[model samples]
Target chain A: MKHQRWLPWVFLAPTALGMGLFTLIPIVASIVLAFFQWDIITPPKFVGFANFATVATDSTVQVSFLNTIVFVIVAVALQLGISLGLAVLLTEKLPNWLRSFFRSAFFFPLVLSAASVSVFMKYLFNEKFGVVNWLLSLINVPAVPWLTSPAGSAVVIILVYVWQNFGFSFLLFLGGLASIPTETYEAASLDGATGWRKLVQITLPLLSPTTLVASVMAIISALQVFDQPYVLTGGGPGDSTRSAVMVIFETAFQRLEFGQGAALGVILTIIIMLITALQFRLSKRFVFYQ
Target chain B: MTTTLEPRRTASPRTRPAARRRRIDWGMTGRITVLVITAVFVIGPVLWTLSTSLRLPSEAFSLPPSFLPLHPDFTSYAQVFQQLNMALLVLNSALVTGIVALGQMGTAALAGYAFAQLEFKGKKALFSVILATMMVPLQVTIVPVFLLIRGMGLSDTLLALILPALPTAFGTFLMRQYFLGLPPDLAEAAAIDGATPWRTFRSVYAPLAMPGLAIVGILAFNYHWNEFFRPLILTISEQNFTLPLGLVSLQGNMGTGSISVVLAGVILSMIPAFIVFIFGQRTLRTGLTSGLGK
Candidate 1:
């Protein structure tokens, strides 16, 4: 095509404008907003480091931070373990129809909206007449308070979050497994390596890159969890399930503390960036990319 | 080592087929057992949701918790529509998702085409800037974005939700990768035939990029359709509520008393996503793997 210098600019204009106005400007604005006190109606006044000071000593922030850490560790660990296990099973030599069936079934939850899943799980874990308690009652077991109690509610949130999200990692692992050349497995088998030995020697080592990606993604999503706990527990009976994002949302929208909320957002972004950067740095020794 | 060697020692090449068949049978049996267990874990709750949605309120909350409702009732679905005003929320969600999907595809394609084919000053720098923004999660920028939307007087409106989401760095990157893989000779031939850059893009390149368009479209649709955080932050009134917000509020309002109705609403909200997934299964699979695998 006849190269026109203006044409590329024309094509790029809408995206640039959109990103500039919404993404780029807001990013800078968020940093600035973290230092200002503003309600929607009133003009923003710069408050310097006051918001950060409050965040440092706030008890709610402390609880939320601890809860978020617990959630990130437990949720990411379980999700990676289960999804990798599922991916390994699905990738085994199986009938074509069965493979597709398992893939679709496992991935089906990813298509459901988080809100829908949350609602479904909320009712499923309801204290009185929930299916879970009812099922427990079938075996002469007493009904457990799934959502009312703090520890139980936290576990429910973790399980539901894992249920809704693990499929993404499963699919990623499946893709990684599919990409491993069969010749490597065949060669290993010829060397009298089979079953668990072959898997530990060849599969785990080769799948390290995929594992790293999936783990990073799992951690990121786990740390950002909001929808499930927001809907299911609303930070619960005692703030046991309150995630950092939940606190941020409630602070900004519910309480109209935009400055503090922005401060929290900034803090969260820095924490996530550091964690992600640390993962990438540490991955250099473990993640093989051949 | 002994464990690995034992299986191999059991059969030589002459007897391998028979022994392998026996092992295969055992493996299949074990595999089926594991598959059933996993399938139950994955699909059981989903089936429970459907059953609860269809059951009478009394049956839905019965102590024993029957898997199948004896007298299935569609009244909860009716209640969701009547009491919750689900139809309007569905309409709002559809409009927002549709606009965002089409807008994202259009912008991504144009930007991707430029990045892939056209040379411009600071192309590399600009592309890198866009790519870097992908790392900034929406939660970080949401506060300022909300303020910006309010400042523009777009709050409580679908525009607030639609405008910010129209341009996506990931979509642009996906399209650029796809376009870069296209044969360059087609565009060259169009150029030799006196086609302008715009004309070449419109006729020669656009048609070839339909797969990329579909991938972006499906992804954008799924995202905006299910998006809760943005709508929750932006929209104020019940009239402007998307399906997720509506369902959530319905859960709160109904409490535990109207569980069937809430389940019905949940099931209703999932129908569109299920339809999209079924129809675009192949495209979505490829899109996810290719987008994230690298």
Candidate 2:
């Protein structure tokens, strides 16, 4: 029963070592690397602010930046809207088996890797032989160039991203819906609030905490999207679907430009940090904790 | 959870008026219709993938793409295994995922126990640091992490992929939250019985934390299994590739002509996750809700 002073440290040592080596140190190293040029072979040369200057002027970086912003906005909006709708519907009075089945079915895609989904969707959206175009053609519609055109590929990426991710938000929303006490609904009904009015006045305000969490999660994942776009379009169709992470990957690994890549990473980190901070600050009026 | 709501309806049948009951029926019908449509929309692509994976090569791109293959073939599965060397890639992915899962579970449990039970200097500050790391996206640190791995001569090796991910901030946070919710009297009784801290943790807390452990393990497995970017960056040769990387390579080499084979590879890659999901659906759902809902 003696309190061993070092026992806690012993317990913490492994995680501390692993996290420090992998996450903490690397983070600091990334910030430092943004100022230096290195190709993994030569000694890094210090070039303060030069990499940042390049990122500011780089057209591909600009395109990727714009694409990432647009992708996050559209994807988050669609995902939240659809997932919340599904959650509300699924939580209604239905056969137990049907409810469970629908829940599992909707969540099935979350278990699959984004890479697999991307590949399957790439084939699904194939310009010539894809099932999507085929289905469109069945209705006397002309074949659409899904992955071949810039705007088209962008749309595909957003849709694919939403498909792969909405399940997560759906699950969270279900949890939120379940936690709402039945008395609240009864109270709202007594007050003559039902349907759209009930959802907007009572359910939504009470569910704001869940909404806040889901929105934050959706935004973060959407902004960091790499796998779907990478595997599906390879950042192609003239770099339409290229995300910030994809650009960083190509810049560092393909072009062997570590400094610029590090710079881009820093810029991305700052942008995400700022956005998350702003969300938290702005959420004060909307998020209801009780 | 859904079962709890069922009784509310049964209890209301006698008290509810006829008009209310009829309205409820209409609502049920609308809900079922919407649920069916959403289910189809969500699961349609997966079914399509299954169909394409089984279809014969010639029938894969037939003018009217068959909803179901007329003559199903398992040959593409064979092709993926034989021609693309998927077995090795699967084994590699399994190895990495297994190690990372075990590593994360063990480390997270130990750290979580300490943070939840023991009083240590700088514990609060240290825990906050871990939480902060969760907000720092992996993309932000990829350059340095990549260089660090290369410097350690782990590039192109499974170790490169496994080592960096072993200590997960989210996993530790989850385990800690679970431990915090556990009653403290059990640990206190163990201490009064003259059990050492390690024994108390091993014999008492660890067993009770199985649900938390399972959640962490399933999540870690799913993440490392589906991971694409790290393996793509770390490994250069086909021999070191994981499933995602291998599937990409298969697509590149096979092109559109081998669409069936590629779909087979995709289907094969999805099976393990599907199996895990089928068995662990409850645990996965509980884990997700608990982690985020709190």
Candidate 1 local accuracy as lDDT? Answer: 0.88
Which 10 successive residues of model 2 chain A have the least lDDT summed? Answer: A1-10
Report model 2's TM-score to 2 decimal places: 0.95
The parts of candidate 2 lying over 4 Å away from their true place are B1-19
- List TM-score (chain A only) for every prediction: 0.97, 0.97
Candidate 2 second chain TM = 0.90
- Angstrom error of the Cα, residue A28, model 1: value is 0.5
RMSD for each model, in Å, please? 3.1, 5.0
After TM-score superposition, the amount by which residue B149's alpha carbon in candidate 2 deviates from its true location, in angstroms, is 1.0
- lDDT (C-alpha) at residue A123 in model 2: 94
Tens digit per residue, CA lDDT, model 2, B94-171: 999999999999999999988998888899999999999999998888888888998898888999998998898988
Residue A206 local lDDT, model 1: 89
